[model samples]
Target: MSSAYDMIPVLSCENIDKEYVTERTWNGKTKTIFKAVENISLYINEGETLGIVGESGSGKSTIGDILGNLKSQTRGKVFYRGQDVAEMDEESFRKYRKNVQFIFQDPKGSMNPYYSVLEIIGEPLKMLGITDDEEVIERKVLGIMDKVGLSKSVLNKRPDSLSGGQCQRVAIARALVVRPEIIICDEPVSALDVSVQAQILNLLKDLQEEMDIAYLFISHDIGVVNYISNRIVVMNKGHIVEMGRANVVFANPKDEYTRKLVECSFVN
Candidate 1:
């Protein structure tokens, strides 16, 4: 018999393609089509971290946004628990939204400056109809904040007043408040100091072990991905050029682009 981990994918993408149409004046006014993503397909198992790495403009973030339901793909299908997400009814989609959360690159900008830390973390709970009771919401928010290494003293403060790492903690706390099954982290630690990045990555690893949550971690840094990911997928100009176990890909990169990425990661 197989364990729950092997039963079904937490998230799946099939032949996903994304394109942007722009009007340009190259010769005269003409329409230009840019392929942000093309024929990309991957999946995340329960409690697994699938890391996507590439240089800037490689469509890593676009893939993250599509997976998180922040944007729609131009073609192909996204499935949650073997069910097509686009075909989900409103009620099912709402539940899917709660189960899939996002952690953005710019921690400070992702949050509202005017909202208190408590409010920022608790807002998702309220939006999901988890609870309307202020006391219960605060209790849950405080609990998650503690788990994310935040102090109660910062609860009443706005995100602007907190350090970069602290702001990211709040974001993590917010994502955890929903008890999400999958989180799409888009360069979640790139903006923070090197020391702080390690802390956040460690926290994510710990949480994954404890909660059995799956992560779609997107970043330009192969080293960071190698530290946290079980499997790694390398993207180039929207195409998946190389993918394999983190160690295997890092040790013996098969593609030229992947080799270059590995080289640059070590150099930097």
Candidate 2:
């Protein structure tokens, strides 16, 4: 018998296209339509990581936003567990929101400065109707904090008082508090020190194995993406130029853009 990992995809998109309309006054007043992502299709299996890599302004975050349901696609459909996200009822959508969470790159900016560590991490559980009891919430929050390797001493402290790595661990704890099935990690470790980046990456890997969660890991660093992803999707100017297993794509990129990216990774 097939397990959950072998069942339907945890999240997927079909023929996705996203457009941004802008008014430009460079020469004269004119409307410009920019395709941030075009005809992108991919899936993330249960407990698997799918890395999306591209340079800045390559539409990596645009695709992540659509998949996380933080934004809707201009065209095509998004599916969660084979159900159309657009067609879901409010109740279903709420469940989807609880099941799929997003981890933003800027940990400090993503969190409210006023809320303490406990409040920041426990917010999701409260929103998901977990419980109103403070003791229960604290217990669950502490458990997740430990899992993320965060110290309980910082529980009452604010985000401003934490280091970059600590802030990120808090962010991860917040996402994990909901026990989400899939996480859209948008350049999660891009803003940290190299040593801290490795620590966060290892923590994420350990958590994935422990919790059986799936990830759509979005990043611009080819080396970092290759280290963490099972498969890779190479995006270029709003298009998926190349895609394959992580090792295969890194060893032998097919598209010109992908080749350039591989070469640039070495040069950097």
What do the candidate models score in CA lDDT, each in turn?
0.92, 0.93
Per-residue accuracy of model 2 over 31-79 as CA lDDT, tens digit each: 7888899999999998999999999999999999998888889999999
Query: Where in model 1 is the C-alpha error above 4 Å?
Result: 1-6, 24-30
Output the lDDT of residue 160, model 1.
84
Task: Pull out the clashing pairs in model 1.
Answer: none
Q: Per-residue lDDT for 1-268 in model 1, tens only?
A: 5785668898999999998877677776657889999999999888889999998999999998998888999999999989899999988888899999999899899898899999999999889898999999999988998899999999999988999999998999999999999999999999999999999999999999999899999988778999899999999998999999999998899999999877776644
State the displacement of the C-alpha of residue 87, model 1, in Å, after optimal TM-score superposition: 0.6
Clashes of each: 0, 0
lDDT of 1: 0.92
TM-score to native of every candidate shown: 0.95, 0.95
- RMSD for each of the candidates: 2.3, 2.6
